[model samples]
Target: MSASPAPKSYAPWLLMLPALVMVVVFFGIPMAYMLRMSFNLHVDEKFYVPGFTFEHYAQLFANPLFTAAIWTTIKLAFAAALATVVIGYCFALIAWLKPPRWRFLLVGLALCPLLISEVAIIFGWWMFFPKNGLLSYALVSSGLITSKFSLMYTEFAAFVGLIYITLPYCFFIMLSVFDGIDKRTLEASADLGAGPFQTFVEVLLPLSRAGLAVAFSQAFIWAIGTYATPSALGPDTLWTVGYLIQDQMLNKHNWPMASAFSMILVAGVAVVMAVTRSFMAKRQAVHV
Candidate 1:
C-alpha cells in the first residue's frame, strides 16, 4: 500500500491573515491617506479636498521655521539619547558589579521610572525645577546658591527631563546586556594587568555595542515622539516636530499640513531606525 500523503501547512498563514488585514487597514491605509494629503491643498479653513499640489511640501521645505524645528528635534533627541546611554551604562555597571543580593535591587531602582507614566515623570520634573521645588530648595539650603534659583523653562531642564524619562529603558537594556557578559573575562583582563578603564574600553564596551545601539535607538525614537515634556520644561522657542504636528492639527486647524508634518516625522524616524539597524547588523556580523 502507498504511504499516506503529508498534510499541507496552510493553518499558520490563515491565522496570520487577520493580523495582516488589521495592519493594512489601520496602519497602511492611514499612511497612504496621509501621504496623499501631504500633496494636497488646505484652502480657506475648509475640508481637505483632493487637489494634487506640491504647495504643502514646497512650503514645508522652504519655511525656515520647519527647518529650525527639524534641527531642534534632531538635536534634542540625539542629546537625550546620548545622555541616557551614558548614565544608563554606569547604572547597569553598578548593578552588574554588585553582589547577587543587591543586583536585583539596583536593577529594580533603575527601572522604576519606566513603570511610571510619562505625564507623571513630567510632573515630577516640573515640580523639581521650579523655585519652590526640590532642586532650587536644595541649592538654597545647601548654600550652593544665595537664593532659590529656578531651572524651570530652561533648555537644561528639558534635557534633564528627557534623559530622566528615557534613562530607565536604556538602563534595563544595558543591564540585560551586561548580565550576559562573563565577569570572569574582566577578572582575566585584570590578571593580565589591564586597568579598569582599559578593560572597559577593550572588552566591556565592544560586547555592549549592540545594547548601546538598542538603547540609543529606543531613547531617540521616544524623544522624537515627545512634545509635552519639552513644552512644559523648556522655553517657548523649543518647537519640535511633535509640537509642530500638534499645532497644525489643533491650533491652526490645518489637517493636511498636520498630515504632511506627520509624514515627515515618520520618514525622519524611519531613516534613523534604518541607519541604526544597519550599524547594529554590521557590528553583530563583525563580532560573530
Candidate 2:
C-alpha cells in the first residue's frame, strides 16, 4: 500500500469523551437533582415530599423578607465590586509604573492574602473591629481617642471584609491587563502634553475597558456568593440570598425551599454574567 489509512477526524472527540462524561456526571447530574427538588413539596417534619408544586417559586416573591434579602445582596455586591475595581485599578497602575524590584514587591504583597484562608481572614477582621480589638487599642495608644470604640457588627465592617477578600483577585486581573499594554503609549501621551489624569482617561481607560468589566463581574460574583464573612462580621439585619439558602437547608430543614433559593441564586448569577458579557461585547463593537 502507498500509505496507511488516515485516522478519523473524530479521534480528538474520543480523547475528550472522558472529560465530557466527567462534566455530565459531576455538574449535570447535581443540577438536575436540584432542579427537580426545587419543585417538590416540603413538610415541617420531613426534609421534602415527592410531589411537584410551584408553591416555592410563588412564595419567593410573596415573602417580603426574601425579596429584601435579594435586593440587599445585589446592592452590597455591586457597591463592593465597584469599590474593589477602583482600588485594584489604582494599585495595579502603581505597580505597573514601578521599577522591576518594586514591581515584584508589590505583586508579592498582593498575593499574600490569597495564601490565607477566608476563615482566618474573617477571624482576623473580627478581632480587629471589636471594642477591645487591635484597632481600638491602636487608636487609644496613639491618643486618637480616650476610650475604645467598636466597628464590629456593622455594615461597614462587613463591606470592608468583602473588599479585603476580593481585592487580590481584582488586582491580579488588572495587573495582567496592564502588563499587556505597551509602555510607549504612556510616554507618547506625556510627550503630547497630556496630563496624567487626561492620559489615564483617554488612553489607559479605553484600552482597559474590557478588563474592567471582567474584574467587576468576577468581584461581584464572589461578593454575592460569600455569606460567612458578611454574616459573621455584619449586623444581624444583614440577610443575603446565601444566608437564606443556608437557613433553609440547615436550620429550617426545608430542602425544597433551599433548593428553590439555590436555583434562583444560580439563575440570577447566570443572567447577570450573560447581560454583562453582552453589554461589554456591544460596547467593544461600537468602539471598534
Candidate 3:
C-alpha cells in the first residue's frame, strides 16, 4: 500500500550531466577558441597575432585556390555520399531479407572495414590500386590485360576509398531502420502485386526515409572532411578544405587561416544536420 516514489525534477538533467559536461568541455571550448582565433592576425610567418582582422575570412572567396578546394570538396562529398547510400541500401536490404543464419556473417563483413584504422584501410587500397598490386596481378592472371593497370592517384580511386569508409555507417543505420519496420507491410505489398523494385521504391524508401537522410548527412559530413584518403589515393588536382586547413596550420604556419577554414567546415556540417532534422520531421508528419 506504499505510494510510488515521485519522479525527481532533476533526474533527467542528472542523467545527462556527464554528456553536457563533455560537450561543453570538449566541443564548446574548442569551437569558441577556434572562432576567436579565426579573427586574429598572422604576421611575418609567426604562428598568430592577437589582433583582430577579417582578411582570413575574406580570402575564403577572394583566393582562387580556396574557392576551388571548397567546390572540389563539395562535389567529391556529394558523389561519395550518393554512392554510399545506394550501395549501403542494397547491401543492407539484402542482408535484412536473408536467412538469420547468414545475417551474422553479412553484418560481420560490413563491420570489417570499421575495425581497421582509416590509415590502414587507405594503405590496403593504396597497394591494391598500384600497378604491381594484387588487383593488377589478378587481372593479368585472368588474361584480361597484357600490362599492369594502375588506378592509383585517380578520382575513381579516391571515390572508392571515400565510399569504403562511409558504407558501414550507412549500412548499420539502414539495418536498424529496417529492423523497426513491420514485416507484414512488406508482405502486404507483395501480396498486392508489387514487384521487388516497386516495393523498394514505394515502401522501403518511404519507411526508411529518416534513416536514409541521417546516413546521407553523416556520410556527406565525413566525406567533406576527408584529408588523407584523397591526398593519398587521388591526383594532386584533388584539393579539399581539410587539405588547405592542414597546409595553413602546419605548412604555412597560419593559424588564423586554418581556423577560418574550420569555421566554414563546421557551418556546413551544422547546415547539413539541420536539414536532416527538418527532413526527418517532415517525413514523420507525412507518415503519421
Candidate 4:
C-alpha cells in the first residue's frame, strides 16, 4: 500500500489573506463610513445627526458655487490633459528617435517633476511667476518690458502649473507606446516617399491611438484631483471640487457635505475609468 496522497487545497489564498484584511480594514471601512456620513443630517455648526437624506447631494446641484466648481474643474482638466498629451507626444517621439544616450537624458529630465513633491513644485512656480520673480526680472533686465509684469494669479499660470505636473506622466506613457513600434515601419514609409509629417500622420498616429486615449484619461484624472497647484498659482475665484471638499471638512466642519462631494468626485473618476476601459477593449477587439 502507498501513503495517502496529500489533499489538494487553495494554499495560495493564504498569501492574499493579509492584503484582503488590510483592504477591508482601511479602504472598505472608510468608504462605508463616508457613504453613511453622506446621508446624515447636519445639525448646527458641529454635530451631524444620523439619518437618510438626499439633501446634501441635492444642494450640490442647487448651489451656484458647486455648479461653477464642477464646470471649472472639468474645463481645466480637459485643457490640461489635451495640452499635456500634445507636448508629451512631441517630446516622447523626439526622445524615441534619438540615440540611446540622448534618450536617457531626456527621460531623466521628464522625471524631475514627478520626483519632486507637489507642494515643492507649487512653491517653485509661485516664486518664478511673481512680479519680483525670475521671469519678470528676466524680461525687465533684458529690456523686453518697460516694467516688471507678473504672470502669477492668472489662468495662464494655472494652466502652466497643471501642465508641468501632468506632463511627465503623459511623456512616459506615450514613450512606452512609441518604443513598442518597429523602427523599420518608419523606414519603410520613408522608402515609399512618405515625408516626415506624412509618416507621422499615416503610420505613427493610427498605431498610437489607443495609447493616446489611455494617456489622456490618466492625465485628466490626475488633473481633476489636483487642487493645490492651481489654487496657489491661480486667482482666488478659481475654486475646484477638491478645494471645496477641504473647505467643508476643515474650514466649515461640515462632514456630511464633504462626504457628499468626495463621493461625487469618486463617481466621476469611476465613470471616466469605465469609459476608458471600454474604449480600449473595443480597440483590442477590432485589432484581434
User: Which window of ten consecutive residues has the lowest lDDT sum in model 4?
Assistant: 4-13
* TM-score against native, each model: 0.90, 0.91, 0.95, 0.91
Best by lDDT: 3
Candidate closest to the true structure, highest TM-score = 3
Per-candidate local distance difference test? 0.87, 0.92, 0.94, 0.92
Across 1-288, the per-residue lDDT of candidate 4 in tens digits comes to 997745544556677889999999998999889999999988888747888899999999999999999889989999999999999999999999999999999999999998989999999998899999999999899998999889999988999999999999999999999999999999999999999999989999989999999999989999998989889999988998988998998898889999999898788888989999999999999999
Model 2 misses residue 198 by how many Å? 0.6
Q: Candidate 2: which stretches are off by over 4 Å?
A: 1-22
For residues 1-288, what per-residue lDDT tens digits would candidate 2 score against the true structure?
596656887788889999999999998899899999999998766899999999999989999999999899989999999999999999999999999999999999998779999899988997899999999999999999999999999999999999998999999999999999999999999999999999999999988888888899889989998989889999999998889999998988899889998888788779879977997888879978
Candidate 3 per-residue lDDT over residues 98-181, each given as its tens digit: 999789999999999999999999999978999999999999999999999899999999999999999999999999999999
Model 1 bad stretches (over 4 Å): 1-26
As for candidate 4, its clashing pairs are: none
Off by over 4 Å in 4: 1-25
